[model samples]
Target: MWRCPLGLLLLLSLAGHVALGAKQGRVRRELAPGLHLRGIRDAGGRYCQEQDLCCRGRADDCALPYLGAICYCDLFCNRTVSDCCPDFWDFCLGVPPPFPPIQGCMHGGRIYPVLGTYWDNCNRCWQAGNHSAFWGMTLDEGIRYRLGTIRPSSLVMNMHEIYTVLNPGEVLPTAFEASEKWPNLIHEPLDQGNCAGSWAFSTAAVASDRVSIHSLGHMTPVLSPQNLLSCDTHQQQGCRGGRLDGAWWFLRRRGVVSDHCYPFSGRERDEAGPAPPCMMHSRAMGRGKRQATARCPNSHVNNNDIYQVTPVYRLGSNDKEIMKELMENGPVQALMEVHEDFFLYKGGIYSHTPVSLGRPERYRRHGTHSVKITGWGEETLPDGRTLKYWTAANSWGPAWGERGHFRIVRGVNECDIESFVLGVWGRVGMEDMGHH
Candidate 1:
């Protein structure tokens, strides 16, 4: 029963040696230069004898979950799981660590973990770790504290009446930005400090842009937000917050002096009272002085001339119509409801995303806000999904979000930005002048 042939035994032995030799050869090729492929058991740990490389405990620890326990010196190592293999960190870690924190804006990509959070020092805000743009304040607090200034009773334009109409297939420009048309007109982002006068700041800025564009560069006035915050209290409650419509009406009625005449103090209150008196003293006091007003300290009377917005009206909900208005009229003011996640936006087209798991409640829904819609464009994603975006300017300083501007998902009334968009013609005439 046990009769064996010498030929059969020889064949089996040859096959085993051939298989073992093939594995050894493959390992030799993979080993680094000068490293002899040999079996070794030194103090540190087991060396992969076949590959002539040290197999650190981490590699063996991760072998069962990732590659099999058969360790090799190939590209199968994961930095997250086992440092032995490179470039497999994301694949093995499941949720890997994020990129090292850096300055300014950054796109969320493979390098930056989708689960890590970062802080934006320039704007004094924190961002949830994810693939979305990061802004300092979530939409809610930004609007509530900075933008929710419009009063319902103080609305000057009748919102119920729709003014814009869409002609079917109206071939609009693919992109439109006020800054492009009038580069010198776009003012730097204004800082509201601790006050919630975004309504006043944005309104004044819109007026400034319009005046510059409409006058064909003849009139470029940095209309005063302090004037609106200090004097326009009849409808608005001072820096406590005012409505855009109300601010526009006030500008039309009483008008406002230039920032040249009244410098911005960041704070809305004067030490004397809750509302500060509009200092009519024309002088080169604080920053933001132009050559025209550089030496015009004695020209107080000229600086006091009130600037107004004429024929201010509401924009329609139609996206194209709004874009058309921006192209034709210049920058317009729009109210946006800020979601909680909006505050962490560093850069990129902003959209709402759910709060990351285990994040604080601040990542939840916040409040309403206002911004100047400067331009619009369509962006195609890698997956070929096309998204329209509104290039909106924020009052936050240039250090924040795309040099003081942010792109929000457009067309679908993102954050209700398309709702109640307001446009105005700055009252520019020969009579509007400042004596230096």
Candidate 2:
């Protein structure tokens, strides 16, 4: 359910299992020199090797139609080929084939290669009738599609002199997590569905976390991204995507009701249809002074249900300063760019690399995205280099990217994550006073 960019939406919509359609070459009955077809005789999926064929192991079985035919091991074939024997046969004969698109990785392994090619069987693409998903788009195309509308300076705040003052002991822990230290304050990971509404999701999630943490859990409540997506059309684009600045600005000025009052509809559709028209009920609830349209039913703003953010400001790019804010207040929203290999990420610390498995065109920064920065940590690599990482919450469902969370290389401003961090003060309630 991880959201893709607007431009990728069209391409992602077209991704699917393309038929290789390699005009079935004539099948050969006689064995050729240095060719060994294993598992064909038994058909029970056993391995056999010949010295001339050079089968590496059990999986390298050259069986059936691939045994003698000049099988076309093309890119699509490598992705969707029914038999594993052709790959083995090609390898034994010194024929190089493109790497498979989809790969497996241990849940928490330290070492995993980033896959280059698009996943041939992405469920999202299948659902959308597309041949690929986010991984299919090139870096430049993704960047232009996703970040084309973002305004850089809009995220900058004037609070540099205030939170940048990091004390010696409280600078930053080697590792920290808002969810671990303050589970009550951390909201659950949310799914943006197929829409590019990550700006709204991340902004609302960070604000919700900050509200709960600042109020010491007394005023904990899940804020509504639907409210922003449906009602904040003046400065923000609903499903076509929006900027973090505009989302925060909407929260500060217009305010929003709880999710119960303005439930999310953008995610209800798996196809990620266009954003629904601004609901009359939500619009009336979000506006401060505007009276509810008398003819519109259930369109009144209630003081008890309404919540507003005050003094939303951007944080400096300093890593320790960002950590200090999270430790003191709560999670902050991070604007970032992503690479294609990110789709293959399962777990462990992630850092962008130029290539994966020696493929020079892999892992390029493909698109812009936003997430909630909840924690920070450091890990020691085998080479003795200290790898600092940031724990961020994704808009995709918990089924993806480490249970809806990911750790990226930190301190060096990887993917511009350190740049344009934003924080805000949530509306305080009377019930929260005693708790704090």
Candidate 3:
């Protein structure tokens, strides 16, 4: 959903106005980042009469049409995913003066300014089908594309909570290691696509991170996207892949078994027989595609898709710089392939899924990633409205979110740090409980 960032034309226009003291009417407070700002008050006058910015992104007025404000989000700024979409960033591209917004604007490893509708790099292309498809999707689309609103309702309380988000095809790697001090400090094991269990995966990953912090007497659970897609404990599909509570129960009695050391298939259903004759490392399309609601196909292909190397260490003076700037800036961005199911979540947990206009199998690499920012927002939008936090771009997908993009809510969750989706919810929890 990192498709369209702030319009480039709008960014340039804002910068120019700020520099030139152009005039605008009924000026609002500071401009909302990632918004298209124009016709604002300048030092010389209340409003600038000349069209300072280009018209390449020329669509109908973006701000409320009749408001006659200097700026407005385009028609594509506030619609929902009712039907299939073609392509949405063409409006700004076709125009000459002001450029159109483009998708994947920030993926190629570059941090862009919060410009308005500026199309460049991987963002340039024909936007006919896309533009009209999102005729009124700027607002919601941005939220969908920017914010990774997906989540699970349940929570876990242990480091063993890891391992639920793998796909149905994989098994726990025998090479997996446990805490050196606590031999029984097992990680959670899970199934695939059963519980819409991103929370489980999150728990696992965070547990790992917290494990590193275990010496401090603390543990933080995280969702695991990998296990959800790979574990395959259940027959269901989508981002909601595994369960943490179930994982807890699985290990409660049995301790923890290796993915291959055990011979059981899946506890969910639709299995050919016993577990596919493969290990978590086997890659046999384990547990089917449960836990695969978020679309992040081929993301791991690029090492930079998830984990990123930091230039500064958090334990040193440079660490302060990281906390102040880099943490909020995040580490990476890209498109994750996921199922269309995520669309159901809007402005909430697992709400990042967007309507794919193409065949489901086609956008296998369509998930969005974000920068781990510590804090941001309370700024204005393109149409003179204000909101907190600007959703960073990811290759994932888009929704009718803020500024026609998805965003990361800074300073709220663990989003400020680099996040790796470990695995999703699986059926182990349900199976151990004797219910599905």
Candidate 4:
């Protein structure tokens, strides 16, 4: 006959009573009420193993008093509302536990139940429900929430013809940067924040550069994307998302005041909310020009003169033509398919990686984005591969990739960036030149 130590037997009986209390919807009674006891091993250490008191069947007496609660030693304990001691399976059943201890996943000092998720910027993360794994946002969710450029309608895409042609004999430079070529003329990259108004930001950036260059640096104004986001409401959705064609149309027809007059308010509102109300208005001048009728939105700045651009013209998908146009004029606007990995870009020539190929389709997602194609260059890899890239300015601010710029693999229509490239001339004239 096997007999247990008197103290050990008492603990076993107490553990059984605690388990019974738990099963009967009552608070588990404990001698040490203030002790912490959720983990596999408690402060006392190795209760079931040291006692060697595992029961062979569903024996009522087979239980262990853990730190402050009860854990069972019989097989029946694991069937429902598992209260088995950490070592019950190993010592009693001669097998490892089916799963690791049921401690919830910990993040930022908070415990999240299995399958709980949280978003970190554009990426979403979740705890593994049953396995020791983590997952991120689905591709569909990434496209829906993180990206905002709308695919152009066939009518809008074909409206403009290629506006520039390459000279057969004239040589094109191997590298070019708008900021370097025309110092102080190219506007610094601006942060769009979480707003999906790249349509407005890119259009405004390209217009700003072209206006300054066309005016010979005399009228270097940072044009307002907010003007476009709020006022260009005919066929646009403001920060929610918009089309470049519509944005350009608004810039040409109505015109926008400089950034000083109407500052950006897109960052202050919810990404899903409507853009701030149209704060600035304009009246048509005698010619195809207009004048702002409202005072500057920012009280400190008084200048409210409207800036306009010639109708935007598209460029052929040929890289040389795009480069030639950029060098001769200024930065041009281009549409691109932004993939999940694009958000993580830090630097270097970027090409869409196929890392998500084997993963589920939910993990592979992309959305259209508009950017300013500022320059172009070629990088020769150690393996003697020449990787041509476009130096594009993103609206994500100067802190992001390459000082607010990113180099993407050029030519081969990477990310459809070259598919629908566009350029425009600032509507600068003698009157505008005289004032500046």
Candidate 5:
């Protein structure tokens, strides 16, 4: 009597089949490209074949969509010898690795030449939350709409609403600014993935922005979810799902995080560096590794029932209160992180073939989920000239669409763009002082 994961049953779809093995230890299965499963194995009716994750024989596995491997949480699980895979929640040693800017570029704010137009990452943008990513109107929808349903999916924020507010005449701007750039807004990035701190990330982004403007003073950047997660303070880990005030407390203690490297043992570890410049494979190597499957819910926060959002805002609409804080005080440039899935594009789209997220329902590629409000620009076109609305920022150079620079939208682009800002999970590392 196996029950499907709460979230997966509704939206999860099976992708390529994994080679089944003997019926015994935890079942093993591979996921689509880039979907790394950090805390579980795809044990679909397989048996005693004895496949292992991190092979440490203790904690569960944390599978990410990409990176072609899973992170193992052994030792913490206590059962040194077992057939069961470590549960996502039971195994609790989470962390954030160092992710310095690569090749003199920030994550979502890079200067690149696109369509013969050279765009500057920061030229017309405001850096909100400075280094962390943001959840604008659209992204929030993606999260609420699919958070429980989809894993490893990006939620780009929809900015059509943003435009409506900024330009009352329903006029579009060439670009918008970010909140961090706002005079007195709090510039805190939530301590996420460093410990599954998304709960903290979201809440803090909203709360901090609000409080910072209260008393016309800087927001209470003292939100620290880590304190709440501290087993010492409560029964939770210093790194579970993040929340607004809970995360605010955490960020007040520690700022932002990118949770990038530190290869966990027994998973697809390191790649030979001195790797060639980011060039498409002239000849594909052995079909590179696959994504991770088998997801387990984390129990650190207040529930095993993933913290569902209460109608805080009207579905896709931003809290007018918060938006007021965000808009007037913000126009900040949050990190522009493109998802790893963005690289999974197929042939006609560009030079590469569209790679699958491995699963049928999940997004095909990792695209941008973070957005920034750059400067508003008026363009002269037909119909007495029109204003193009959009934000500017960085996305990994790997993706297409808004991957290289802040993307311009006629307003409400598409799912990828919508999920881009508020699509929840994203990695944000600060830039070197001189780089921006």
Candidate 6:
């Protein structure tokens, strides 16, 4: 008779039987001289089982000859190469085997293990614990909710016939600022909130500056965007979005009131809510002008006079012409393609980046946005390169980029900003100045 080891005898004594469920046809098979094993299958389709093969404590003898290879039945097997038999968990430990090792996450033709992360420029992409991957919000949402200027028709875009004549003998400065030239004349930037009404905001801002500058600081009125949002409804979508041509047309024809007279009510509780009713209206006062017909929305403000501007004209895409127009007049209105990354701008000369180049189409969106170009300057980089930039006023408020203003690459028509530059003259007559 083959003598069982002391450890095997101890295990068999505790089991109270030589085999498991012999009455149910579960018989022990002799594999080696003294080793009797029960039948079970592993992931590799090899037969394995827990007989008296488990090590009592930490012995190297707790292994079985499995298909010409050694498969450990010891507890130490879990800490090493995990070469334990499949039934070692069920028969020895009374538990099911753990799930198979999860495969790595695949993206952009690369495999990333769970919890792996990588940064695509400013955006971070990572794999989650549940074997899934996640990327940040789509660019479409940023364009739809944050920016609101619609692309102008080709006719409007190509209407650059009206150019600002440069002086033959005069020399333009390397850098110039409208606010510095006419202090207290340029209007500070205003917040458009969630409203996509850059059309109204930029129009009103540029008009306000021109009105003040043209009047020699006599009539410094911050024009109301709410007046245009609520009243200028012909082919306009209010907060949803609108065309700059329509905004300029309304400023030239229907006219708008001062912000003090009719404050901005474009910020809705929900972005989809309807704009407030037209609180201020005007009646034709002859000479292609108008006077306020309704009382000022802000009752405290008694100046209900309607502010108007001359017909807007486009400026040539030349940087000198744009600079000359901005310096000679006040700020000029410009249409730019606001890319998804623009919203992350804190400071510096802005330009569209290729960070989202490998991203999906939905993550690389751009929308038209209008802004006021107030000045231009050049910065010397560490690499001895000079960066020319335009200082422009945004409608996102003062707490944002560079105190409600931003600088963008100049001369290259970056984001089509210089592609459709426009300037206007405030309808400041003798009577308008006398009132101030």
RMSD of 5: 23.6
Models 1 onward score TM values of 0.61, 0.65, 0.24, 0.68, 0.30, 0.69
Evaluated against the true structure, the overall lDDT of model 3 is: 0.27
Model 2 segments more than 4 A misplaced: 1-81, 85-162, 168-171, 268-274, 280-304, 356-365, 431-436
The lDDT for every candidate, in the order shown, is 0.58, 0.58, 0.27, 0.71, 0.27, 0.70
Candidate 5 per-residue lDDT, tens place, 1-436, comes to 2233441212111222232332223434322221121211332211111232342444334222211123233332223322222232232323221121112112143221110111122112211110112212132222322111112212222233232244454432233344444554544333232123333333434433443444244222433222233311222222322223223223333232111111101111122322112111112122221111211112222211101111122113332322333345443223222332222221111111122223343433232233333333344432343434443432222132343333343333323332322212111112211234
Worst 10 residues of 6 by lDDT: 125-134
Candidate closer to the true structure by lDDT (higher is better), 5 or 6: 6
Regions of model 4 farther than 4 Å from truth: 1-142, 268-272
State each candidate's clash count. 20, 7, 174, 0, 97, 0
* Per-residue lDDT over 1-436 for candidate 2, one digit per residue giving the tens place of the 0 to 100 score: 3334442321221212232223433232111211112111111111223223324432222233322232232222232323333344344445532333233232232212233222222222211221133443454544433332254453243435345786666545688888888977898888776566888888889888887877778767788888788888876777666877778778877666666556677644333456676653423433342222222223453433556777777777889888888887889888887765555455667765434444354334467788899998887754555778899998777866777788888888987888778888887756446733
Superposition error at 142 for model 5 (Å): 18
Q: Which 10 consecutive positions of candidate 5 have the poorest summed lDDT?
A: 260-269
Top lDDT: which candidate number?
Answer: 4
Q: What is the C-alpha local distance difference test score of candidate 2?
A: 0.58
- Against the true structure, candidate 2 reaches a TM-score of 0.65
Tens-digit lDDT string for candidate 4 (89-129): 77777786655544444445433322122232211111111
lDDT of 3 by residue, 1-436 (tens): 1234543321222222222111222232123222232212112111112222222332432232111123332333323310001112222233222323333224234323221222332121211112222233343343333233232233321223222233466442211122232333323332322223333233333333333233232222223344333443443232323343333332221122222233222333333334332122221124321222232333332211111111211211122222232222222121132333322222311222222333234432333322222123344434554334323322222332222233432223323222322221222322223344
